[model samples]
Target: MLRHEFHPGKLVAGLSLLTVAVVYAGDAGGAWEAPWFVALPLVMAGLLLAGVAATIHGIRPRGAARPEGGPQGSGKLGD
Candidate 1:
């Protein structure tokens, strides 16, 4: 399996949605009362947070070192 970069944005989004689901589930199970519009702000906040995370991730630079013999480090034009 190929390893991939960790994405904070996705984590935030998932957690936000999970929170909304839990709220509704709790209400349905008679654990507590939840307003119908409760999820609106939560989802909006999640989207905003995810966008910020993604923007920061994209702006950040990767490792400075380049693998030996890789096309990127190779001096020759065109891989």
Candidate 2:
């Protein structure tokens, strides 16, 4: 196991993608109907939300306090 700074943008992006996958999976499994148009909007909205989240996180002022032993000054989104 490992610990690191939590990135909400990434989390939201992942969840959004997962939700889309589940919906299509359900359709494939014959559980329900999911039209092609549904996926287009879903993916676009997810990307928009992810971009907003990342922008928010980037603009947030860095506080004096941070979790001890965390990586510092990585300057990368995936860090």
Candidate 3:
């Protein structure tokens, strides 16, 4: 039962797909316009941004030692 950190990368990646789906559904319902070419790059950028962010986020404290865990049932990741 560890308290997790917020992950912006995952959020961006997920939102990208969600945006695509919504736009596609809207177009199908004659409520929006979206070309595949534009959509493709947008999706690519989203994924790329997500990856880059994730990499950067992961790089922080990248080669350093982690802190010691607290007592048991302290709601941490590892002990």
Q: Which numbered prediction scores highest in TM-score against the true structure?
A: 1
Clashing pairs in 3: none
lDDT of each: 0.85, 0.84, 0.79
Residue 75 C-alpha lDDT in model 1: 59
Q: Best to worst by TM-score, what's the order?
A: 1, 2, 3
Tell me the tens digit of each residue's lDDT in model 3 across 1-79: 9988878899989999888888888988999777766679779988998998888777876334344443434546672
Lowest summed lDDT over 10 consecutive residues: which window, candidate 3? 63-72
What would you estimate as the lDDT of candidate 2?
0.84
Question: Each candidate's TM vs. the true structure?
Answer: 0.74, 0.71, 0.64
> Which residue segments of model 3 deviate by more than 4 Å?
62-79
Model 2, residue 44: C-alpha shift (Å) = 0.7
Q: What is candidate 1's CA lDDT for residue 45?
A: 97
| Candidate 1 residue lDDT tens string, 51-78 | 8988787775554334456656565668
Worst 10 residues of 2 by lDDT: 61-70
Give the winner by lDDT: 2 or 3. Answer: 2
